[model samples]
Target: MTDQVMAAIDGSQFSTAVCDAAAWASLALAAPLTFLHVVDNHPQTAEADLSGNIGLGSREHLLEELASLDEKRARLAQEQGRLMLEAAKSRAIENGVAEPGIRQRNGELVETLAELEDDIRLLVIGKRGEAAHKASEHLGSNLERVVRSLHRPILVVPEAFETPRQVLIAFDGSKTTRKGVEMVAKSPLFRGISCHVVMVGAEVADMRSQLDWALMTLNDAGFEAHGEIRAGEVEESLRSYQQEHAIDLLVMGAYGHSRIRHLLVGSTTTGMLRKATVPVLLLR
Candidate 1:
């Protein structure tokens, strides 16, 4: 089965952008789109706080009543989740995604993604949650956890949607970045976009050679590719280069620890995500 693009939405302002990005990815890959809204049931919420309000004699009865209440709340929550999913699906359709799938599950986001990892080709989530927005770090730690769990391309969408005509690739001669380069070259995701391959480090001959090799590979793959070398902090060099060239998307490697980091998204760091102004694409 062809993989689908999964967009995680929380019904915040970010949902619209997530849908837009997911729709773009879905169309780009000619794959189906699935909007997932997780009904996160916190452990603390399962039991009602009746101990303080009820006498000991009524405590047992209250516990039974609380159990019933919990059931009712769960039902209501699922209904609300369905509504959120419907709205998300409508947004995806309006954004040009045809017949997008809607999934409302009761579980942790990372665990849920893991369960469906085999079916998802790309994962799209907001760059920031509704409660925070500054740099990529504030996009939420949960967002990082979600990315770390999936061995697929993840599109971290910003506040709005923009067609990515140009992509700036941050390469550091790492194996992960090499994998990212290969993914971009082979995937239909970036077929018609322009790519600027950059290596940020000391202006050593080896650095230049690596950049040239990456550019050659991209060019050989039929991309309008260019190569450059920058000397400075990796993130700052990428920021300046992207700004000067007006890059629409930033494609790099993973973030996080353990096998998840190495297998997906690659050497991309949280600091880089925190500083980015454009959408970031991370491939493992």
Candidate 2:
């Protein structure tokens, strides 16, 4: 991946938070920042075949009128996306991103992101988009698709953002999570921050061994790392620890062979993403 932090911005309430989170990440990682806005390909704005065989009558005129309306709608959508990108760029600049790049494309969000996945080091996006704002219980329509489609780490920010002082890793000792731990240890983004690796289950030999390994790995990297084995439901235990310790950032491995098989397959990962008030950094 290239050394750049890309923030997906829509004109929703979470746009400001996305920019702030992206700016924070860019500064922490010392990478260039880019703002991306996609004019979603909605069926209503799709091109229509007005030239199709229409009995020469008012129906032909109506089809032409519909096609013209679709064109106008598409133009309006493009303009709106452009304005949103400009606004997000301004916000990122104010938040200390020097000169953020801007990309406005007309396509599906997931497809656009997949096309740029190889060049993105990190992606920052809102937890919910304009379409899902009315449904607080749901994630953005494209969030899960983007996560599953792209391999880069994603920082999903809530409607508000603040620099994280404490990070909680929902460690499971799986290969994916182990890689995540290693990434956290080596990346400059989490430098000088308190890290807590938590595994939820009965305190057994295997669990203890993995926990110790994670601690050692992090400690070796010069982090103030702490390990814990909490017993209870996965989501509840993690959420409780996060609230009790005032954790500002949550880290997890996505689409692993562990419990996070598929993000939306009724797993703890889905619950955490749905209810998490803090920003979650998902590593794959």
Candidate 3:
């Protein structure tokens, strides 16, 4: 079976942009694309009255209004999701992807996604979700939570990217870095794109071997790849390289070392996500 590319759609305008990116990846990877819409069970509710002095009819009317509003919101959400899925499917078909699936589930976001992660090769989500405004710099709570929880690669699509021409792979010779390299080697999402494998904090002693290993792996996989080893902070080196090379997208491991180690010593993963100017593909 072809690997599945899963993308979460929240019925927001930004979601359409995410779908476009997912479709591009699905086509490139020759993978079936799955569009998932998760209806939040924890709908916003009005504050409860501590004092029961109000009349029964007033309370009944308020409850009825809330129910009606929830129903309307749910309907709107489903409609928007359906429309976007249809558009995405159409685009995928145009690009030669066959029979993409669209699914909707009503439940907690994190639970539902966790359940689906087993079969998904790639999880695509927008940088923000329904509640996020176009001007917001920080990611939405749902997207952020998923990133922290899911042990999968997530392509966080930004608002401005239409297509990726150049890719930056953050290499550190860790297990996660190997996974990221394997992903790029096998997946068509990176085909014909210029790949720059960057190693930060490189000592002069082993830099040659490390660079050679990376170059050999990528070349064996039929990718046009290059390597650069730099000394200094990982985040700073990556940012500088991005600026000089005009990198369109960044691919890296989500967290390196142990969780305890990451907590005690700050991680380059966290730093790059906060500071990167381009879209990031994070592999866990």
TM-score of each model, paired residue for residue = 0.87, 0.92, 0.86
Q: Quick one: best TM-score, which candidate?
A: 2
- Model 3, range 108-206, lDDT digits (tens) per residue? 777898888787888888877777765645656677678767887888877655678888899878777877887888777888898889998756757
**Deviation in Å, model 2, residue 98 alpha carbon:** 1.5
What tens digits encode model 2's per-residue C-alpha lDDT throughout 165-284? 999999999988999899999999999899999999999999999999999999999999988999999999999999999999999987644465444423777889989899999888
State each model's CA lDDT, in order: 0.81, 0.88, 0.77
Error of 3 at 119 (Å): 2.4
Better of 1 and 3 by TM-score: 1
In model 1, the Cα lDDT at residue 175 comes to 86
**lDDT, ranked from best to worst:** 2, 1, 3
Candidate 2 accuracy as lDDT: 0.88
Best by lDDT: 2
Model 2 ranges with Cα > 4 A deviation: 45-56, 257-266
Model 1 / residue 252 / CA error / Å: 1.1
- Candidate 3: stretches off by over 4 Å: 50-52, 133-136, 256-267
